[model samples]
Each structure stands twice: as structure tokens, then as C-alpha cells.
Target: MPSSKPAFFFSSTQSVDNRLGDVFSFIWGSYAGLRELWWQVRGFNTQFPDLHISEIENKFLAGLPMPGGIDFKKLFVKTDWAEHEKDFSRWILFDVCTLYEGWAEKVCKDLFSSSTYERNAKAIQFPSGVRANRQVSGYPVAVNEANTSASTLMKDEFLPTLKKSYLNCWSFIDQHLLAYRFFKECRNSFIHSEGVVTQDIIDKHTELATIQAVKPSPFRNNFILPSQTLGQSIELNLKDCINFATIVRKLICTFDAALSVAMASEAILEQRIRNLVSNNPKWNNLPSDPAKREQRVHRMLAASRIPEPQNFANMMAWMQSKGII
Candidate 1:
């Protein structure tokens, strides 16, 4: 099986995390199921040597539900199982790439929407110390070379939006950001180049990484595709997918732990809530009394979504802790 032990990946950001989990589960579930079928068919044949393999396969597939838009018969014939398993692994990594980028983009948009922050994030000046790739401090990002990644999203969109002092809190669990992007480069090749290893992906390999922290991933070497394999179709096997998925999950967990703590603090969350309440004129017609107005605001906030901070325990906890409605 291509699966490791089940992982429970979540940020305090339930909305985004849940979506990520759902996508991860669906792709992984299908990958394991394909391999599981491969083994089960052989095991069943061992028990009943006289029976035809075709009969056993038909019986097994008949028991499984056939969803719309899928041609299971043509897709999963006797000879197709090996290729099918390989295909699932390829897609699993591809899907993982999409999930990581989507979640990062969503969080980036949410965190930067506060009215108190500069409207033009590019205008904000981040300190040199923050950008410098120091020992275990921060990894250098290659936004120009790569298509999309956690490092790219943070460097290009999210980090610029935050105040300069808060940069210390923004640490990555993954030290080798370029090594991580190599997997994403494979993902892009699959997407735009139709699974063929392109010149672009080969060029980015091994050399594209700018920051190699003192403690980089042991799998850092895995990011480099052999130069000989260029121009050929990507040979994404089960092990490759296992590595890709593990790294993506680790990054998400690390990001969630750090950002959730920052979000819980008064300096960030309070300003976010203030921005939300102050900017929009939607609550102009509240009750005249102070107590009634406070009650109404909490009620309204509960019903509507909290856009900033990206994740939270609840609105009430934040309201009581921060002394804001």
C-alpha cells in the first residue's frame, strides 16, 4: 500500500483545513484502493486456483459502486491494474500540489484584507534580516523560477502584508523550500506539459534551490530528476508520491501551529476585528443602548463569516478575550 499511518492534519483554521483534508482523503483513498485491489485479486486467486481470474475481478467490481462519468470497465481491466496504480500515484502528487497552493492563496487573501494594513502591500518595506537566509531562521524563496509553492505564496503575497516586527514569528517547518518546489515543478509538468519532463523542470532541478539550511531534508537529493530522463514522460511511482504527500502535510501542520498562535494574540486579531467592524457600514442601524448594541453586534458577527485571521476557535472566544464585539 502507498499509505502511511493515517494523518490528522488541521490548522486552527477549520474552514481551510477541512477542505484540504477532504481533497487529500479523496486522492489518497483512491490510490490505496487501487493498490489494495491489485493485492486482493492475487490473494483470492491463491485460495481458489481453479477459478478464472476474470470471474473474480468481475465479482469484486460488481460489488463496488459505479459512480457517474467513470468507465470502470474500460479503466480497470486485468492488464490495466499495474498502470492504474501508477496513474493514481501521479495524480495523487498532482492533486496535492493543487491543494497546497489553494490553501495558501486563501489564507493569503484572508490575512491581508484588514483596512488597517497598507492597501499597496508591495509598498511596505520588509527588513533585510527577515529576507536573509540565516541558520534555521528563514529559507530563501525562488518565486521567479517556480510556478507556485508555500514559499512563493508567502514571499510574493502574504508576508509583505504583515508588519515588519511580526516576521520573526513566520518560521517554516520545512527548511528546504527549493527541494519542496521540485515536487511542484513535477506537478506543473504533469499539468501543462501532459506528464512529460520538460526542459524547464530539468533546469530548475538541484540548482534552483537558493537556501539550504544547515539541516535540510534528507530527501533533498530526491528533488533532482536525472538529466537523462528529461524529455521523457515523468516516472512518478508510489514512493515519489509518498514523499510528496508527507512534505506537504508537514508544511501545513507547521504553518498552522505558528500562524494560529499569532492569530490568537491581541496585536493581530484585535486589529482584524476592529477593521471588520469599522470599515463596513452594514451595522449602522443598531440599537441605541450600549449593551443592546454590543449584543446585536455579537449576534450579527456569529451569523456572518469572520474573514480575517483565517482561523479561530470561535468568534465569542476572541470577543471575550480581546474585549471586542
Candidate 2:
């Protein structure tokens, strides 16, 4: 059954939004502290003058409890400071990219969790082109659709669905979407290909130009650039890590705010569609197919001496708004 009451896009993201801000604040603040530690280790010789950082730490730090009686010195001494520098940047890239992908997955889940989206998804006739891979053994068709859609978000051309559903908010951040996709490509390359931009990723990087172009550092004069040479690994510093991490963090929060504001209006608009379908005799007179229904609806609007909306969703919302439903 279709959702009876007007409910969608989450009943309230207020708690989620507030806590998200706090969480990111803690994360980036701690990241700053970690960053300082990185610098302190790098300049250890200059500050200590006599003792190496590994020497001081290894002598006294060994007294701490160890689950496996592991030597703490090995971690610092296994690789020189210069080697540690490269590893730090690569680790940060992997860590933040993982965070971004995880958060986006959660967002996808949340967006399609509503009863409205569930009913709408079920209505989709499967064995059709819209990613209907779920087996119908146990779960309902709608459940399968919703699951497939959420899981596939941002991996395929899933952003367009979000843009249509959350039109105004998505349109506002149009350029941000491009940038987000660009970073996602970088993340894929690093994670799947050992930090070397692959041949497939090269065409995408060339098209997006995000990795190809040099980015300015927020905290220093030094720049972050990914080497475009296809087979070689690129250099990534702390500044490079900071740039992507901060942008992804901001983009998520900004998108949440946008969703919160526009959801109620969109909910009302969606409800209007349900109302027209269930309550109106004119709707029953039309064929069950959407194209035929829309053509009939367009004609009805013209015959009523009213203007037709550009899309079926808009048409239904328009009719309700005009007191014609």
C-alpha cells in the first residue's frame, strides 16, 4: 500500500544534523593535533639536539603495558622519518576516503528509508532498466528496490535520482556534486590500485581535471599535486589530506542542511501525487501505464483551461496547489 500520511525525507534530521556538526568538529580538531605530532616527529633532531625521537621514546616508552609484549621502538624505527612522511599521507588518504564512502552510504540508506520512497520503489516494474538485481525469494519487491538503490548510490549514476527527489538542494550544490565525484575517483584509484592512478582512472581524471590540476594549500605555501604519470604513485602530504577531508566534511553537512529545509515541501508535493491517484475518478479513467496517463493528464489540464506542469510529479503537485485535486 502507498503511504497514507504525508511523510518523507525523514521526519526530523535535527538530532542527526546537530550531532554531525559536533562529530566533525572533534574529528578535525583531533586531526589538527595529530598533524602537529607529525611535524614534531619530523623536526625531532632539531628540537632534541642530542637524542633521536626514537631513542628517547624507545628507552622510556617500553615500560607501558603491551598486550603481546611488543616493542614500541620498532614502529618508529622500522622506517626513517622521511619514509614515515609518505606513509602518513597515504594512510590519511585511505582513512578519509573510507569515511567519505561510509557516510555517503549512510546518506543513501536514510534517503530511501521512508515509507513514501518504499511504496514508490515497489511500484517500479522490475526486469526493467533501473537496477533490479535483488532476488524475490524472501523480501518484497519494494524492499529489494530500496536496498539496491541505496547500496548503488554514488557508484553508478545515482546522484541524478537524488537531484530529482531533492531538486532545489541538489541544484544548489551542482558544482559540489562534480567535485565530490572527482574525489571519489581519486579514492577509488588509491584504494584499488595501490595509489597509482590506473589507465581507466586516467580518462576520468582527465575529464574531471581535479587531480590533474594543482590545488592550493590551506595552511601553508606548499601545494598538493597528484602526478599524472599513469604508472607511478603520486606524492600526498598532510596538506593534501586536509584539503579533501575538509571539503568532504563540509559537503556532507551542507547537504544535510539543504535536505532538512526542503523536505516538508517535497513531502506535500509527493502526497499530492498519491491523492490524485487514489481519489480522482479522472485518474482511474486513464491507462495504468505512466506515459499514457501523463498524456491524458496533459490534455485534461489543457481542457480545464489550466497550464500543464512539465513533469508528472510537478503536475500532481500543481493540481493540488491550484485546488483542482
Candidate 3:
């Protein structure tokens, strides 16, 4: 039976079980809850069907009393949103990690799989420290050549592949991953060093990012640019991340379809073999053939769909040709 494991694969190093759990927790616990709060206070509206922009300023400012009497957290809870106060403040960070996990999973499955791309991603087999160090930390780890692991390749080449392969499987790669990377960096500072990341940091960097993304191109419409401000910047980044996830999911669906076709073909081949035996007169003369009976008894696979790894190579090549490899 074809294995149903690939669709569920998120990351190669991390167990699929762990990665999926994290995604569900982040989306439902943090993103969804905060979105609900945004909806109640300010009102939810969207120009683009899938794009939702909450009345954030109105919702936040409406509850504020200029004087000292009102507790912000207390007022937040009175509206039944108190439960998500912590998440509201930290949703950006949670999304950052969640999107990162999603992208990491696709990369592992698309680029590192032994069955696809025919690349060796496992640890190198050098016997000496000199060779080991060089091999392990080898530049262009893309393993475009046999006996190499592509994981160590420089970002320019690897990232393009990562993006393209992900695109083939998804509608778009959300720029949110880049934002999440920065968010994770900021989160680490707060968590590990007690460093402050203020609006200034986001504004300056976000403006620069806007320029880069806005550079003229035939495909310019594919990119979305946001204004420069800490909240706006972070929001834009988050959008990118969400878009990227959508792309990855799409690719998985494509691969699933291919697997179904392969399984159907296998069934057809099996049926043909049976027809050949029934029509031929040579074996009709002999007693009920044990070999034929054994062949007929071959197990029919369960009527379930699963990912077949054989398509990985074709997927990799297609992605690489599109500059996503």
C-alpha cells in the first residue's frame, strides 16, 4: 500500500506530530482569538475577501479613559477579551514561529528527501576532522552534484529553491516569514537578554523592505507593500507569512493528486495480468494453476490516498526550473 505519510510531513528533523500540533495551537489559540477581539470592538471589514482588517485603533482607543481610574487589562477582560490579553500583545511573535515551522517543514520535505532530488542530506562520512569540517560545513550544500547535502548551500540559491518549490505547491509565499524571522529575533532578545525592540526598529527596516519589494517588475502586482510604522510593518509581515503557508498547502494537494493517478495505474496493470491468464488456452488445459491462484490472491491495497515519494524528484526539478529550487 502507498504510504499516507507525506501529506502530513512538516519537517524532517522534527516529528510531523510535533510540527502539526504547534501549527494548530498557534492558529486557534493565538491568531484566531485575537482576531475575534478585533472583530467585536472595532468591527470587521475587508476589501479583499480573504483579507480582514479589524478596526484596531478604534477598538483599542475606545476602551481607554484618559485618567488613572481604569485598568487597561481589566477593561479588556470586562468585554470577555481579557482571556486573550497576553496573546493580543504577543500574537506577532506566535505567528512568526508558527509560519517558520510551516516553511521549515516544506523545505525539509521538498529539498532534503532522499527519494526526491537524489541528494544525500544525512551527515557526511568523512573519517578525519579536516575532511569532516569541510564536508559538513561545505559551501553550496545544495548537493546539485552527487554525494553532497544541499542544506549547506548559500542563501541566494537555497532560498530561491525553497520559495519556488513552495510556490508550486502553494498559491503564494507569504512575506510574513521574513517578518517572523525578525519577530523571532526580537522575541529572543526579550526572552534571553531583556533587550527592548521599539517602533523605531520596525519602521526603519520596514521602509527599506517596502522599497525592495516595490522595485518594478512584470510581476510587481504579485507583491504587497505596507506603510512604515511598527504595527503596520508587523501586520504586513504577518500577511506574507500567511500567504506562504497557503502556497505550501496548495503544493501538497498537487502531489496528492499525482499519487492517486499512480495508484490507479497500478490497479489497471494488475487487472491486465489477470485478463491475460483467463484468455490464454495454454494454461486452460492444465489443472487450476497454483501460480495463477496465488497471483489472484495478491492483496488489494486499502482504498485510502497517501503521498508517494516517487514524485518528489519531479517536483524538485519543476521547482528548480522555476528558480524555486
Judging by lDDT against the true structure, name the best candidate. Answer: 1
Per-residue CA lDDT of model 3 for 205-276, tens digit only, reads 563365446545212223343343433213334444344334334433322222222223233323433454
Give lDDT per model, in order.
0.48, 0.46, 0.37
Poorest 10 consecutive residues by lDDT, candidate 1:
120-129
Residue 225 lDDT, candidate 1, scale 0-100: 40
Please give, for residues 1-325, the per-residue lDDT of candidate 2 as tens digits.
1112111233222234344456557666765664565455446645676886567565544676756753434543344655655656566566655655555445434555565543432222111123466534211343334444342212122223323432132332433334444455666777677767677556544644543344541212223445566787755555665565555554454443333222333343345445655666766576678777667666554333222222456555555575554
Best by TM-score: 1
Model 2: how far residue 76 lies from native, Å: 2.5
Cα lDDT, model 2, residue 100:
51
Backbone N/Cα/C clashes per model: 0, 0, 19
Cα displacement (angstroms), candidate 2, residue 310, comes to 28
With a 3 Å backbone cut-off (N, CA, C), the pairs that clash in candidate 2 are: none
TM-score per candidate, in order?
Answer: 0.51, 0.44, 0.35
Kindly list the per-residue Cα lDDT of model 1 for residues 130-226, writing each as its tens digit: 4244521222121111112223222332333331322122353333344456667778777788888877666546443333323553343343243
**lDDT of model 3 at position 167:** 25
Residue 304 shift from truth in candidate 2, angstroms: 44
